[model samples]
Target chain A: MEVEGMPPARLREPAHRVSPRAVRYWTVNALLGNVLAWAVMFVIAWFLPEGRWWSTTLVWLFVVAMLANVVEVVVEPVVRYRRTRWEVRDGRVFVQTGWLSRDQRIAPLSRVQTVDTHRGAVMRLYRLANITVTTASAAGPITIPCLDTDLAEAVTAELARITGQTRGDAT
Target chain B: MLLLTPVRTLGSFAVPLVLAVLGVRRGRDEDPWWLLVVVAGAALAVVFGVVSWAVTRYRFTDEQVQLRSGVLSRRVTTAPLDRVRSVDIEAPPLHRVLGLAKVKVGTGVDATRLELDGVSAAQATDLRTYLLARSRVAGGDGEGAPAPVDAPGRGGTSYLGPAQPETELARIDWGWLRYAPFSLSSLVVVAGVFGVLAQFGDELPIDQIDVAQDAWRWVVAQALLALVGAVVLVVVVGWVVVSTVTYVLTWWNLRVVREGRGNLRITRGLLTTHSQTVERAKVRGALMGEPFLLRLVRGAELSAIATGVGTGGRTRVLPPAPRSVVVQVGHELLEEHGPLTMAMVGHGPRARRRIHVRHQWGTLLVTGALAVPTYLLQDLWVLGRLPDWGPPGLLVVLGLVNALVAESAWRNLGHGLTDRHLVVQTGTFMRTREVLERAGIIGWRIEQGFFQRRLGLADLMATTAAGSEVLTAPDIPLDLAVQLAGRATPGMLDDFLV
Candidate 1:
């Protein structure tokens, strides 16, 4: 809350939590992917020689993986949706997300390279869009997924405008 | 004046000659006609070199230098003189003998865009002076003359040096010679010398040589008492000698100076001289690389990350120096003292626990992966089987070492924040501390892997346009990461509630 022209303690703006559709979006994405992987593991385990040390280890691993997937594909998405949030201010962008390891990221509006919006099949069905904010980082772009389409568009336009103002200006 | 340069022809021939010699190596019954192949390769190389030299043509325009060169496909390169960041002239021993030099014109964005190899010394100097003058004039901030033109009648119209008033900042100190052996360069030199000697081992005539024979005899006699001790002593002595020689050759008479418009002009070399001008405006920050051995001796090297400046050797701003001197030089170059002098804030207990866990898990996984396979495969091989307890004992030792290193690494993890800069301290062996201006940070990345997420930890990376382009703070709590990112560039995260 050290933004320019703002008081230090006043106006503690709460983060905008992502829409609930994100939970459904991520849960389906995770379950479909993990189920297929788990099936392959189970098939491999079934074909293993019985009562051997390696086979027994495989069985134990498969069981652990199943439990892990249950948490990851089902319970994790809800917590993740609750955690995912983004906020736009006068000259910066702040995003926070993560269920187990929470990440809070802030990008100065001056350094914003580009703001892109996209809608996949699932997102389109849910009338949602994902806004990806790209900076000059090789780690990849910052994506805010499963926001309402209108909100996503508004954020994109606002970011583009802010970045345009600060473009080519030295710090 | 427009004739092909002889040095270019020799350079082109070198690769083919080496390949031809390698192909015609001493013993190969199947290749009795190797001489024919070698001759053909050399002839081909000569033809290609001649053609390339003949085709290449360059001319100086009013605002740009355009070079066209290609035998089949016409490749034209246009370098704007005003944008020229550096004009480096290099003359190896052979080129020096022939009074020729290689000129490299760098714009800093694309690094070197034009290289005029094997030009006469006079031409190289003229080009360097003409290009550098225009670049300095363009960068002069409206304080100097607009531009200086080269007169056709005069042979050497302008002095072929830095285009502005210069002041020497630092030069090679003989006292710093002791620090050379501790650098990685010494290890490289030792390794290279060993490789060459090993390659010619059969031709060495060791028994025929009196000194070598005496040395061997001494080694053998010493080995009777303690073989390992004798070998270790020889290695240590050899390492010191090789390292010192390498350091002297590379850093002899090194000079760093200030050029026009906040540009640093560095010139250093033993046999082949190198000069480069670095614009400080493009510099994001400076990093101090302190290797384990160097740190123990309280020594470090400084490098700055600037746009278009390649990392590693290219970014080096200061040679190996004591901590106090390096810090002073760094502060002077950067013109900021806050970030360099700020006290660092350490990570929490959870971060330490995470590091410990990671080390433990890594040790377990590696031992489990390697030891089991080795044991199982040992019985299949005819060689002697390892003792049953060996793998577990080795694993325990490795685990202890890993634990110790993990604790040290966790202790080293810290970050410092000033009003206009952020400093991140990291590294396990080669400890690197980077001081970057907050204004240079373009964006931030927050990453949380599954295990890290489970521990409520995250890594926040500040993305910039200079150096390796990313400065990361790993294993910090989510709340702290938020606060840190906000504090790093104050106006950026005002609306975010952590």
Candidate 2:
């Protein structure tokens, strides 16, 4: 996008995508959340009186939920997988994520305080891991999720090595 | 040390003791079970205080200061002398009466707060000077050499002697008290007072007071307009008095001083004096606050954006004062005039139109919500027939107010870049101009929502460890956002830019 009297500028997509297996992992996560929400609605509907205005509302809500469940499980994961990207260069780590609302972050290696790899139970089952790069800023750690475990480990190690080579305190 | 335990214990439990005594006096013949509980709690507190005091031990070595305490599970905290960022001394009313002060050592880390809870006031002063001096030596020399022990005024016994040379930056001015009422801090105090009164209304003898009864009768007799005028007059007078008193109690004798080693020391408070020190190297920026009311009177407040200083890592450098004085102090704090005085680049017409649309939509949503409920309830017998014009009138008034707010917000939206600092201004009610050092920025975050993307706009934030963590320029053109981030921290975003 360009503004008057200013040079046109743009940010290129980061170089790497998360592992392909992330689609399956995200699908399962979304299904689990949908099931829990649907179960709560069913329980409420069971207690509600029949032939009331709310009962009809609940029936309509069920239809909406079924359609939303399809979108969440079938469509969101694929779009998220396509959009998420990350890259680590000479002195900086760049991240881009989110399907609907795009976000881009850049943190210099000299300012990096720590790096860690995390794997949840389901992620472990899928052999996927997440890497978190923390800096002194409270905007919070930059997370690259659903990477192959070995790739996550390599990224964490590389980040640590690069951050360690710098001399000043992170803050 | 042992004698201080009971005194400190009783001081903290004074309110409970009074309540217990009142309870016993009211029920002369009844069992004093609650009093026993109160006494037992006080005794437990004293025992814990004594035991903790006995176990606590702190020792300062050439390289590190270590403190060890705890009976069941001992934990030792050690901080390197070179990393020391500040040393603060505080004396509450009771502590001052006992000639004792509490010393807190900050190392620019949030978790570990090394505190000496109770030390003789004189000893506290000596310790502050000695520790700060050692930190200065270690920081300036870039070596872990032991600081000299025989420096003048370093000895613990000579605390009453002349202090180190200091340059005064600012001090409290009585003329600034005029700005207190405009600050509206007294409204908070008044609300708190009303809340407490409500909580204990039944226990008080307010209804029995003849003067209160007479006042209520007079209020009921007055016409509606006269009553409103009287209430407003009372509120304005009360607000002026309360805010002035609060300002004096909080900022009496306030002084900002620069010590020989460049540490900024701020001392203030009447009953509970506070002495805070901020390391020169840790200072990242300055924030100039111009609340709408204060701005009308051409006044502003200044605060320091420093690491590990005060709550939220911000230290008030000046109270509500003249805008010129605020600018002068800000210039001194940042050690430059360009960032504070530079002209800001506005976000242009697109951003202004975006804010107007957002605010108008908000006004429409609120009006619709309120109108639906009011319309539904208008014919109900219980509420009496409501006026037909209420909803539309509300829409007209709120729409006008929000339009003004949107215009003001657009005018306030601007950012500037100086050689060493990036300045961003935001907010409407309490507009703030933040001048943050480019060197302090650790990262950049560029966010674009669906609407923002369609408008080719983005919010650019610079993340740092000091003061609020993130400083943002909202609704700027996407290209300008990228350019600002790239130029602020050279080469940090170059690899990602196309």
Tell me the tens digit of each residue's lDDT in model 1 across A36-67: 98889978987899989778987998899899
Top TM-score model: 2
Per-residue lDDT of model 1, residues B1-498, tens digit only:
122343455466778777766766756757658777756765665677677788888877766778899888899988776567566677776777777777777664453458777788877867766676666555553354664556333665543333557777778888987887787757776676667655765664445545556778677556545744654566678898887877776677788777655667677778776666655565678888898889888899987666544333146767777877778777776777756556668888888999999889888887776676567766645322656776687689989999999988988888888766789888788888898878788777768778887776778788776667788999877667767777786666554542
Chain A agreement with the truth for model 1, given as TM-score: 0.83
lDDT of 2 by residue, B185-280 (tens): 568876666566557546644454555567775654464457458656766777788989988988999999887667789999999988988778
TM-score of each: 0.76, 0.88
Least accurate 10 contiguous residues by lDDT in model 1 chain B: B1-10
Best by lDDT: 2
Interface RMSD of each: 6.2, 2.3
Q: List the residue pairs that clash in candidate 1.
A: A100-B453, A101-B453
Q: What does the lDDT read for residue A38 in candidate 1?
A: 86
